[model samples]
Target chain A: MRTHRFAGYLFILPALLFFLAFLVYPLLHTVYLSLTEWAGFDLKKITFVGFDNFKLIPPDWIFWKAMRNTFYFVVGTTVFLNLFGLGLALFLNNSTRFTHVVRTLVFIPVLLSPVIVGVMWSRIFDPFGVLNQILEKLGLIQTPIFWLGAKNMALVSIIGATVWQWVGYDMVLYLTGLQQIPEELYEAAMIDGANRWQMFRRVTVPLLKGVATMVILLNFIGGVRIFDLVYVMTKGGPNHNTEVLATHLYEVAFWFNKMGYASVISVIILAISLVFAYLRSRLMSEEKA
Target chain B: MRKTWILLALLLLCATLMLPAAPKTTLRLWSWNNEGDYPAVFEQIIARFETANPNAEVEIQWVPYTEYNEKLKATIAAGDYPEIPEIHPIHPGSPMYSLYQAGELLSLNDALKTGFPKYFPSALADLTFEGNTYSIPLDVNNLTVFYNKNIFKKVGQKIPETVDDLISLGKALKAGGYMGIAHGAKDGWPAGDLYFQMLAYSDGSHTMLRKADFGKLTWNRPEFIEAALQILKMNANGVFPPGTAAVDYFTGAVQLFTQQKTAMFYPAGSWIVGGFDTGFPEGVEYGLFPFPRISKVQDSASTGGVATNWGVLKKAKNQDLVLAFYRIAADMKSAQILIDHSMIPPYAVNIQAKREILADMIKAQAIAQTRFVFTPELHSQVMSGVQGLFTGEVSAAQFVAALDRVEKTIKR
Candidate 1:
């Protein structure tokens, strides 16, 4: 028994070392960096400023704007992704030949890199692009709309692109969850004189609680750390209208060379993600109970 | 037999040890100038350098222009930068300035004192920071209106010489169902350059601009606000292509101009001459003209400076080899290579213009003014403000106010 336990420890030692080296060490270093004033060069030259970086965060309007934008993306993506994912899953539950083709077609966007998605969507939303031409043919408006250029529409456009790419992923996850729920549950509900809506509400919703929690949590976290699409499309531009926490952090660290302040922003993002994770775990536990 | 074999091995070892080993050194250079004729130009220069120093080799790393600055910064932060890094757009607020401030660049004052090619005074001034020259200016360029002669002829429009004339021409072009100017405001720098040109024309000299940059003057001054308003006015008049705010420089403006989707001209730098020569469609005859003066009373000022230059890292191992390469690069031979490729070498060599447009560009560069300096934070803010103006997100006063707010936050 002792030998077997030692072998198991030895088997996992490499992964443990990798986890410590890559994850734990960087997290700790980032925390240390948040307290210092460093230009991200010359590790020896990092000056300990002790909460000064964090203090600067409150008065910085751009940082607050980025936070607000991130919040909007997270909430917006979560709601839409869940709504669409569950709807598509329920619709495609029958698994016909046509439904299979539709599933594959919808999943195509999920397989594309975010950078490619951003570029493709940018063209589609271009003022003189196909969308505008179609609208013009319909005589919907006199002039072209600046989808990515307009301050109000830029973030919304980014959100739309992100949801398009990830909705298929959510649908697939929900389908797996939906398949596991036995038909007997629906039959039992129907035998009790429950209508179609009541059957769906009482049986489907109750059974898929675990998968819904996972899908929503995954989306919330993904939205919080969103960077590449916003970067490639508008670059958080048109006057920082689409600026999010990740892109702002990138600009601060790389462009402005304010590594320490960027680290602070990173810590804030981590904190938000942790709080969400904790809430998710609580929800899961409560559901289990 | 064993004794004979051992004696032969001993003799072979002795002969190998007696022969002197060849000395070799490798010089690494990083640059964002990887497009068009730049690679061939660099190759020719490196071949000359290698021929002159038989034992020395040059390795060039070409980074894409968009990601070059960020990559350079990150590599330097990681303490892994190349020995000779090219610092482009060598102005007061450029990456060269930041690198110099961090004491990462090698001061070339002593090296430049002797046996160096003579550069234009203005070009040298742009590369110098606080009485110390950090980089050798490779080339200088200025913004000019690149117009398709065919489109201008079709529209029966003459070149505009003043701001008002340009506005009227833009309106006329728009009325004819053509895009007046195909500006790519997405990259931010192009729009910023246009605004700076407006400022230069408004102020005549860069005095107020310099003062505002150094925090000695407020950015919300009438001249600055006027420049902002001018850009907004151009946008409002349909002077720019639709979706101009979202369009990027290369894929948007350059493509539109080359494809004849826009009429009249594009406000861009002279560096694009070489690219346009190759990229422009057949029968797309183009011409160069200076940026129109804001007022007839004011002299037309071209906004540009040294577009390409190189600096040595302080921690470079092969400083002697790097200096040797620089000496070769600064020679008239290298200048001829760049000139042949349509680049304006900083050297004062007599330019025998191969193309009529190149001659016009050289003339425009003669009266070129250096762009206004800004701190990195302030520069980013100004770029955002310019984009906002084009996108109708902010008005001229609002843009100026935003600049003032950012300027106030910078500590000296």
Candidate 2:
């Protein structure tokens, strides 16, 4: 029996070692780095400054701007994605030939890499691009709108591109949740004189709480860590108007070589993500209860 | 009889194994020059180096320009940098400066004592730190105005000789319903370059800027403010493209110029000469001219420095092979190869321009002045401030003051 347990441990050791090496070790190293001042090129040159990097965060206006932009993106993407995803899922709950085709079309953007998505959308948002051309043809405005160029519109444009890409993912998840609900629940609701809207509210929503929680958590985490799309699109430019936490971290770490300060920012991002994940677990447990 | 034959075969195998193996060395080189005719040029140089040293083999890794610095830094941090790593910018502001300061780069001083071709003094100064030469510049380039001849003819404007004339030309181009000048402010560096060009013209020298770079002087000087105001004035007059803040280097500025949407491309480097020869559309004729003088009392100097420099890693296993490679790369024959590919070599060579634009670029490089090397922090701050200026989010006073604030934080 002891030998059997030892054999099982031996079988799992490789994976456990990989997890510790790639994940846990890096996390601990990053925390240690956050407490030091280093140029990021030399490990021997690291100077322990004892939370000085954290102290710089509050006073740096760019950091505050990035935080605000990140918050806006997280809230914007999460709320809108859930709404559109649930709406589409409800409209195409019963799978058919047309619904299947539509579903594929909607999910197509999700299949594309974020870099491709960013490049495609940047062209679309160009001043003389298809979007402006259509708006001009329809006499929507006198001048072409600089979608990615304008300060107010840049973040909104990124959020829109992200939603267009990932809304289908949320839709597919909700579709699965919808299928998991028993047909008898809907039948009972209809037999009790409940209308379509009433049935949706009482039967569908209450039953999909678990999937909804998962979707929201995923979207929130994705939104918080958003990097590639923004990096490729705006590069946190036009006066750092669209700067987010991830892009700012990249700038400080790679461009500025302030790895310690960048590690501090990374720690904050990890903390935010962890708190949201904890809340998600609590909510999931409550739904089960 | 079979046992005797087996013993004889074993004796022959042992004799073959006793012979010494041939000595072979492989030298790895890393660079961001993968595009254009760079691959062909590098191939020729490597071919020559390998031929000169029969026992040596050369391996090259070409990284994309955007990701090269960060990737190189990561490799260095992991202690896996190649023997010959290309140090782009090759100035104090570059990430290689930190490596040099950390004693990670091999000093090329002793190597420079013999067999190396004469390089431009300014280019050599750029690669030298604290009296020690750290890298050798493969090419040097300076910025000049690239004008679309078709647009110039259509607008009936002549090449500007002074700031007033340039502004007038801009107005004429705008009035003709064309973009006056294409400035890629979105990328940050181009915008900062424009500002620095103006600052150089404003002060008649890069002295003030250099002083500020060394923390000996504040950035909020009269000349700095004047340069900022000039950018704003040009913007206010509709001299730039619509939504100038949104335009980037490649898709915006180069595209606009090649497509005949812009009358001129301002403050572009000599490195783009090769790109233009291939990328320009048929019948789209372009010409180069020096940046117009901003002050009548001072001569307008081109803002440029060396590019595509090479530094040897101190931990490089094959130092002699690395030195041999550098010797081949820094010679007149290598200069000729670079010239054939439309790259301006830092070494003195008999340059005969095949194209009119190349001739103009050569003329511009003759009068080019190297700018001060800014720290990375100051560089970023200046670039961000320039973006703000282009977007009209900050005035000249505000821009300089912000730079001063950032400058105060540097430890010097």
Tell me each candidate's TM-score. 0.93, 0.93
Query: Model 2: chain B TM-score vs. truth?
Result: 0.90
Q: Give the range where candidate 1 chain B is weakest over 10 consecutive residues by summed lDDT.
A: B88-97
Which segments of model 1 are wrong by more than 4 Å?
Answer: A1-8, B1-24, B65-70, B73-79, B88-98
lDDT of 1 at A239: 84
lDDT of 1 by residue, A1-289 (tens): 9999999999999999999999999999999999998765566678999998998787777899999999999999999989998999999988689999998987899999999999889888877777788999999978988888887888988889998999999999999999999999888888899998998888899899999998999899899999989999988887899999998998888666677899999999999898889989988899879
**Cα misplacement distance, residue B23 of candidate 1 (Å):** 7.7
TM-score of chain A of each: 0.97, 0.97
Residue pairs in collision within model 2? none
Tell me the docking grade of candidate 1: medium
DockQ of 2: 0.50
Candidate 2, residue B71: Cα displacement in angstroms equals: 2.5
The TM-score measured for candidate 1 stands at 0.93
| Model 2 bad stretches (over 4 Å) | A1-12, B1-24, B88-93, B371-373
